[model samples]
Target: MNKIQQQKSENISFNYFSLLSLMFVKKYNIQINQKNEKNILSFYS
Candidate 1:
């Protein structure tokens, strides 16, 4: 393959990876929030 085409594919893959990471972070944040709430309640009790 030509260099330009190879570079284009690499860029596309990088973008896809970034999108996946963003989604994962969002899901992680939700779980963290719920866990934090439970922990706070237990500590207070």
Candidate 2:
């Protein structure tokens, strides 16, 4: 329950969520070589 432990937990959560998001994008047949410029732009838009 210390500050350092809390920071580490937050970092691990972020890494896990990021990995899950990437897997989701691929699972739905999303292309990764579209320069990611318009891809992300349209994705979040």
Q: What C-alpha lDDT do the candidate models reach, one value each?
A: 0.90, 0.81
What TM-score do all the candidates reach, one by one? 0.62, 0.55
Indicate the residue-level lDDT of 12 in model 1: 99
Which parts of model 1 have CA positions greater than 4 angstroms off? 36-45
Top model by TM-score, which number? 1
The reply for model 2, stretches above 4 Å from the true place, is 30-45
> Clashes in each model (backbone N, CA, C under 3 Å)?
0, 0
**Residue 45 error, candidate 2, Å:** 30
